[model samples]
Target chain A: MNHLLNIVRKELKELMTIGSFVSVLIMMFVFMGAGSMMGDQGESITSPSDIGFINGDGGLWADRTEEFLISIYVDTYGISEEEARGFVKVMDIPLDDGAAIVEGMRSLGLDAAIAVGPGYSSNLDNGIRAVISEYYIFTNPGLLGSAGSSITSLMIGEISDRISQALVSEIADPDLTPFLLSPIKGTDAHTYIDGELHSGVRPLDISMGVMNQTLMVPVVIMMVIMMIGSIVISSMGNEKENKTLETLLTMPVGRTVIVTGKILSAAIMGLVYGIMYMVGMMFYSKGMTDIGGLGGSSPADLGLALGPVDWLIVGTMVFLAIFCALGLCMILGAFAKNYKAAQTMTVPISVLAIIPMLLNMFASWGSLPTAIQIPLFIIPFTHPMMVMQNLMFGNTAVVLAGMAYLALFAMLTIFITVKVYKSDILLTGIGQTKLAKAFAGKRIR
Target chain B: MDALTVEDVHKVYGDREAVKGIDFSVRTGEIFGLIGPNGAGKTSTLRMMSTLLRITSGRITVCGHDVATESDEVRKIISYLPEDAGAYKDLTGRAYLKFMAGFFADGAEAEKMVAYGMEMADLGDRIDSKVDTYSKGMMRRLLIARAIMPAPKVAIMDEVTSGLDVINAFEIRKIIRKISEQGVTVIISSHNMFEVDMLCDRVAMINDGRTVLCGTPGELKERFNASNLEEVFVKAVKG
Candidate 1:
């Protein structure tokens, strides 16, 4: 134990002396800044709020539909017609004058505005007269036609007919009205499909949040494992390359002890990186609030929201991630002929560890079928983010399952890697073991 | 009793026999030098003797401990310094020494041992500095100091002075002699013929996985009618 500790101490010292220990942290910080600014944040539409409302009106549904149309814009979509008119920014604005709006629609190749005309509700009530209109002054006839349905069609029939009746009572010959509305029938009929303010599934927000923490664990774990594996394998390889390993082997210290000592040293270095990364991330989370669109919660809120179950999930994933990384790195390290080769080999393993993280971070929930989820859940990396998601939305079973899976994988991976490391001490260059080669390929590219 | 012994040790690398059943022993309190040309199986023999490599056949014992079965015992009894020594660059020299000291925690009086090691290396205040800052000579000194500081029953050095300047080499030789005087057995492998001639009590010449000659330098010299150990080696190899 003392001998192993000595090796670890030595490895840690070497890691500190070289600056590679701090490099990943810097990379993560830069990745965070750049990633946040990449999509929808950097170069986007100038106006923060430009809700486009396409008007499609049938001639018979005109007056009542116009009044209903104006009311639905205010009440259903939760945006007042008054606010919509005033909200248009004229600076480089495309929709100011009627001609420009028309030209803009033409350039976009839209045949007509998307409109819910009057009397559309009455037709639906009759079960025969569908609200139909002749779309013109446009090139692309398909534009806005597919997306537009009478507000009456959107709501339940009972509510739709009542709203149509109310709109009809307000005007005579509603057929000539320009703007039309299909009455919002139900109490909860407000469904904003394309509106920006609605909080549906913001993948970017979840991804940024999940990735911030998710990518962090694996990156740190892989780096730590690589750190240790590098030290052990490189130290041995250095000995062999310089013909010194042969000498050490001849010493009274025997192959096992010497190998153990070297491995211990590597493990120790990896642990240091792990600790450094964890602590660094802990510090990093303090500043995470500076970047928005990453789940509108503070790190503190995230921490408070997570319970013991969440920790188990995180812990399991972290353990498994480290286990897999350490084992694979050790195997890679053993095959490397020199320090440079060992380091080169680490790049691929690092990337492989991160693949799971990327998959977990960016994949939309319910999008992956159960068949995919079963295997994906088996990968320890999926657990942390999965658990994070569960915790955020108050899901218990997923958190527990993710934790269990992580634990299983972590134990299995670490055990196997250790076995490979022990067997490959004297073996130089890439060996003939199919499993090792396959894993190496996964790590390298 | 022999301080170190290798009995009919053979090391086979796949099908190639690196060390083909070689045998030798070193006495207590003496400097034993194993000299050989490049790829002469010197390293293989030294490795088997040191317990770093397993013997394909036969046995090796250090201070009465078997190399294979009693490896931990062998480790405790001897310190082996390979020709290419590396220091942990991440640690301060003092911390590194302390860490090495901790290896023999129960037996090693760490504080005193580390201090003596630092003082012997002549590092002064630089002992507190990280080893990455050390020069080649400094690193060599530190490694030598680390190996000898534990005061093992046997010391195995592989090309210990290869990178040293004359001054540092002389200084290390002085330290080796000092260590030997204290009854520690010293076994070394080197290409420097003069060093072997000057320091070894007995010399073994190896070539192509076998020991061609083994005797006191003077005995070999007298037998070969040569002036020095180098000429003796030349004559032995040639014949």
Candidate 2:
């Protein structure tokens, strides 16, 4: 029992390194950042949405429709009457042009606009259906950007019900008004995406469906990259810690062959892991869709489905990304002196994989600012995560470009890894690096 | 012709030099020893000769192939066993031997090498057990077998019997003598002067990265006016 305790104590001391501690801390920060972003989006989902109301029909029913819109803010959001009145802005503008209505909504800082057409009140009073148009201005494209459109659609549905209830209560014959209770008819929603108007489609539904399909790609990519990267690094660490590296290095093999062999083995393992995760994700995504009622619009209907050739391109991109990750890990592993240090070495690769995953999840690549885009593009892992979405949207040029960049990046990493394998750094570690020397306040001779 | 030649070799790590202009030669089938205190650059010298490290200056050749320019050729003819060498813990002793033998030969010849390694290790039925389960002495025997199993032209071993009991150390010494008799040139480094005297045909005493003495055990003792190699090492290193 004492010998067992002694061995346990020794193992604990060996495993608990400062590098491991720092890596955990870094992971904590990444989770916190993601949580903060999600919290912001959550706020957007629950809060009262701002919308512009244009009354083209100068009648009592149009006035009542506008009032019902404000009532949504008061009852649902728990806001005071005065604040609710201000939440729905009544615009005295002509609703003849669709583009002008969208422009008016944007200028008023509203994501959606409701335009009541001419004869709306008269038609409804006569028991004929009154048509109302909902204009959704999509300034951003992602899961986060779709929140406003979702809220606006929910609010519009509630107002239509409230106006119908008012009409039914005032009817002389209650039995006659039963069929006409739902007099308000909403035309197909108009969505302005990237300044181009897409008629008869809701941006929210399109984004939600696209999110469900492409979401798993980035998540699976991140997991596979981190897992395989850790394996390659730990393999090098084990070789060094076991004192087997010296013997292996002295063997009759070229350094390139050694580096390539390690990468290929790790890449094969990564592909196996990726396939398993993808199969699991497929079931998981199906479960989520069923439980959350997230059926939304089908991507095929929105012209965003991937064909056979697109899938092949995505597969190639994924393969290249894995190759790049293995090569990068091989270079980092060269600096690891032991297994403990190798665990820490995985943190940088983790950060790289995670940054792209989070960004791709929250924002569309085309919608991101160039400042963020350039740096994200430079990370080799980002290409695979973005490829599925790009291919879905028929951005074949962008997908091909990403594939080319990934191929270039993979080759560059392999070249560097081979050099590191040939160098003494594999044995001597960071002690000989100029960065280490600089930190030690020593000049290189 | 010399089996190995290290001509004025130097090893530098950034601002510090580990081995400074050390020169030596070994004849075919000779069991040469590099004797030094801790951190005396003995391992660095041997590592450079085995093509595991780059020479900052000068040249080392194994069977007339330059270690720097012809490292691939040098690796083909040499094997290195570090002081604290370990086999893959997950592999059985026989599996580990087979893995190393695969690198040097294939098919029936590789099978023959594995058989020879099993004989050299002499672990009996224990050779089928995982390496991690082996005792320190047993592990040392297995590693020594792995180093010589390839039948390379030169074998470099650092501290071959380090951290072993009296019986284990003596057995390993006998194995070293047997290997040398098989016409394999061996280079070894150790702090145990008595073991060096018994196992080595020639010895070099190094201190502060320089070769301070080089001769047979008897010649070194006589030159330093000492009774044994230990006394000679102390006299030579101190002087």
Candidate 3:
């Protein structure tokens, strides 16, 4: 036990000494902090006069519309003081008598423009519909969409206010006395459901949900790859480098004990960094939303369907996936002549592990081929994300099966690593094995 | 009783035969020297005896346990310092000693053994410092310290003095002599004929992995009509 513990401490100390470990953590923090700050900018409201309108109508309706728009913008979008300054430049465009500097403002990516046509008041008096061209522009097409929707919402509110005022004026008598005088209930009260109620949940929110889920897939893929690849390869390489492997082999301890000790240490580190990276990713996802690159739903909405057992299964699969990676690396390490060579050889294996995760991410579970699925199920990592996805959609049986398969896979990897280590530890140099030689060894000439 | 026995041991690496059926025994309380040229399989022969490598087709017994079948039992009875002995670089010398000590803790005699080993190593203040900070001589001593700290029944040192200065080399020889006198078998391998002549009770000269000459330093010098063991080696290899 002491020997194994000593080995673990030695491994950790070496990892901590490397510059790359610290650098990755530092970068995650800085990027996440910047992202969160930008995400909180809220929405901006601009009026036509803010864009510098000047026309024969003398800005009367433009001024009224600006005032109304400002009120609605304040009540709805919740733009911050700093955000308002950046957005205030768009309000400088003029909109009076159906004329606005639309071309110049559009080129600058200004948010709002109001063009009141020559017969704007005349058309209202004659009760004829006319187009009052109000255009909002933004550098980001998505932000432009949000600005357009906010403008439409402002228009609805203004139209509703006008209708309420007109109906009040039509009945000059106080409205409260009529209800008692008629003694009959107002012709039948009707309840209407507005389409805006369904549409009002911004497309940004839905798209954000898609963006967050997709983002998790790749980051998790890279992390799972590195966790399995780097940890296992480096550790096994270190053993070969120190030549303690020869010492370990001759000890009374079984070859499996040595392999298990290494795998157990690697798994613990993998899980530790795995949890750290998951937390880092959570911040990263939050940061994306904060920076406005993603503006959809929260992460919870996607993961909310997965129950505790499903999460446990996913966690276990991740652990096993790490174990399998460690096992694969140990086999590679045994064949490698030295540390640098082992690291070089393990790269393709890591890429192989990552590719499956990526395919699992983009393709539906059932759509994957049987050959792929059989191998995929046997990989500890392949199942977790897929199972997590299935769990979110309420598939319990898949999660259970995934957990079982991953456990079996972990055991198999352990067995293979031990066999490889026992056979090839004393062998020197990196030698390529033919497809037939992969599961067995032949004497080199 | 002999502390170590090698009976017709052979080690073959592919088509190349390293140790070709060499046989010898080192009784308790004697320092045995093995001397040979490069590629003469001296290290391979030592490795097989130490249980670090397998005997290709012969038997090796350490303290009455078969090296092939009871390797761990054989290992506990012997301390082996390989040709390229390495110390864990990250550990302070003292920490390394304690760590090596911890492996034998259940024996009830570990603390006394470790203390005796430390004193025998004669590292002075440097043992508390990290091994990376140690000089080559200091590192060698620490390795020797760890190997001996367990107080095994026999000790195998292979070219361990390759990098040491003359004075430190003599100091190491003196330590080996003291341990040998105390009933522990010591097998020392070196290419330096004079060092072997000065230190060993009985010397074995290997040529092409076969024992060409085996006798005490005095007996070999008398038989070869040579002034020193170096001439004895040259004469034996030439023949």
Candidate 4:
């Protein structure tokens, strides 16, 4: 036990002192903290909001739409009449001058740019509707951006209907009114997900949710597992190759002591990495979208009101995953002849880690067919990858079940790792079988 | 009193026999040598005596402690230096010695042992430099110092000068003689006949894992009617 403690101390010192470890650690906290702080902004469309108007059609309808945008901004932020004119800037963007519009908005630091499509005038007359392209400087983001774009489109449509109504009313013939266009409406309505009927929930909301769940969890899982695997393998393999392990074994210490010490060291390092990863990702989440929390809006506007329970879910799942990864690293390290061969093992292990993450991104257990969902749940890595999604969807039962399985899996993996150290192949640097020549080989050390 | 005992120690690897029924004993304070060619299993025999390799069907003891059942106790009294053993690369030479010394003693005793190890290294101020910065000879000297510093009842050194320049090898040989003179029993294995001739009080010629002949270097040379220990080794292995 004394030997084990010494080994752990030695391992941690090397890991922490390495230049790359310290630098990367600092980068993660800095970037992530900035992102999180920025993301938690309020969502109310307030005054001093930068709005861009790119007029493509150069027609009466385009001019009218631009006027409506300025009025809405004035009303939304409750600006006074004197300052309302300064709240919006309308630039004449020619049909072929789309590139200039992008550059023009970038310079103005605009939040949302209104790009009037070329077909606006013709489509309004012929089809009673036209498409207006919306570009947010941060690009089209979550709830706030979608809400802005939809509001502009609706205002334009209302103006066009009024114009159509007035044109027919001015006609001398009574039959002219009968020939006027009436807006087409669908009779049937359907929704994919049930429960709380929230308003203004756009398809882009689903897209934002998918992006949030996929990017960090899958990629980081692969990175952390492979990194810990490499460190453990290199440490053990180098000891064997250099013949330091032989010297250590002959010391008056039990083999289990040494092996346990190594596992503890790597596990702690993996946990530290896992924590930094989550923090950085939370901050990165802000930079991706001028969403509810970051954009000075209520986080609930984006359905992203994550509480302490959610954090606990992420923490527990990540901890279990690291524990399991550390065990696998120890076992593979012992099995290897030296560092190089052990490095080769990392490739397959990485692929295994990534498979579940990929699967979770496309197939949430709630949506997947029952046949496929059952098997995916059985795969241990699926739990870590799916924990966030499950919590988001309020599938508390699945998260609890996954936690139970992962705990058992981690225990079993560590048990096997400990058993491997019972007999070691020390000096020869050749692992004949079962970590050493346990049977059909040398009974000697 | 004997410092080490090996009774019919056999080591089997898979379908092959690595060490077969080797018996030997070393008196306290004696510098003993196992001299033979490659694949002679001298290393295997020494390994079993050091409690490094488990015996197949025989008994071994170090300082009256059974190497098999009481391997930890056996380890307390002896230090085994494997061929081409290496220290932690990033640690300073002095730090490496202290790390090893920490396993056996503590407080002033450990500090005293560390001081002795550094003194024996003869590395001057370079002992404070990382082992990675040390040359091959310097590393060997540092490792040798770690092994004998604790002043164990018996020190098992395998090829203490296997790959060294002449001056470095001579210096290490001188250290071994000094260790013997201090009444520390030393078990050394080497193919270098001259080293055995110069340093060993008694020598054993092993071949195919068994000791074929054993005596003092001069006695073996005279008995085989040979000019030196090398000729005696050659004759015994061939027989």
Best by lDDT: 2
- Which digits, one per residue and each the tens of the lDDT, describe model 3 over residues A1-445? 6999999887776555333343455556544633442242222224322331222233443344444444544444476544433443433444431123545554555434444445544433333332344343322222223344345434534533543354345444564333222221111111101111121233334334544654464457458667567656765566567654554454344567677887787778777777777888888877777876455654354233445865666666677667767777777667766576566556556555555455543343453447656766655566665765555444567677887876777678778877675442344333333432442233221
Worst 10 residues of 3 chain B by lDDT: B99-108
Docking level of model 3: incorrect
Off by over 4 Å in 4: A1-195, A202-204, A210-214, A291-306, A367-380, A426-445
lDDT of candidate 1 over B69-134, digit per residue (tens): 887688787887877777667788898788777766534478888888888788888888998899
- TM-score (C-alpha, index-matched) for candidate 4: 0.68
Q: Which candidate is the best by TM-score?
A: 2
User: Over the stretch A313-423, how does candidate 2's per-residue lDDT look in tens digits?
Assistant: 889999999999998999999888899778778998999899889978877777666776788889998889988777766566777778899999999999999888788
Global Cα lDDT for candidate 4: 0.70
Sorted by TM-score, highest first, which candidate order results?
A: 2, 4, 3, 1
Interface RMSD of each candidate, angstroms, one decimal: 5.3, 1.2, 4.4, 2.5
Candidate number of the best DockQ: 2
Clashing pairs in 2: none
The candidate 2 chain A region of ten consecutive residues with least summed lDDT is: A436-445
lDDT (CA) per prediction: 0.59, 0.85, 0.61, 0.70
Per-residue lDDT of model 3, residues B145-185, tens digit only: 77777777888888978979998888888788887777788
Listed per candidate, the RMSD to the true structure in angstroms reads 14.3, 5.2, 15.6, 15.9
Per-residue error at A419 for model 4, in Å? 2.9
Candidate 1 lDDT over A1-445, as tens digits, reads 6999999887766555222433465457545733543322222322123222333334444334444444544555477687644432222222223454445444555323323444555554443344322222311101112122222333234334545576566655556232224444222111111111122222232234444554466556555655665565566556556544543443343344554555455556666777888898867764674656533323232332466866766665665555555555555665777765556556545544454444444443333447656755655545554555455544567777666665666566555554543342454344334553554333211
1 against 2, candidate with superior lDDT: 2
Q: What is the TM-score of each candidate against the true structure?
A: 0.63, 0.85, 0.65, 0.68
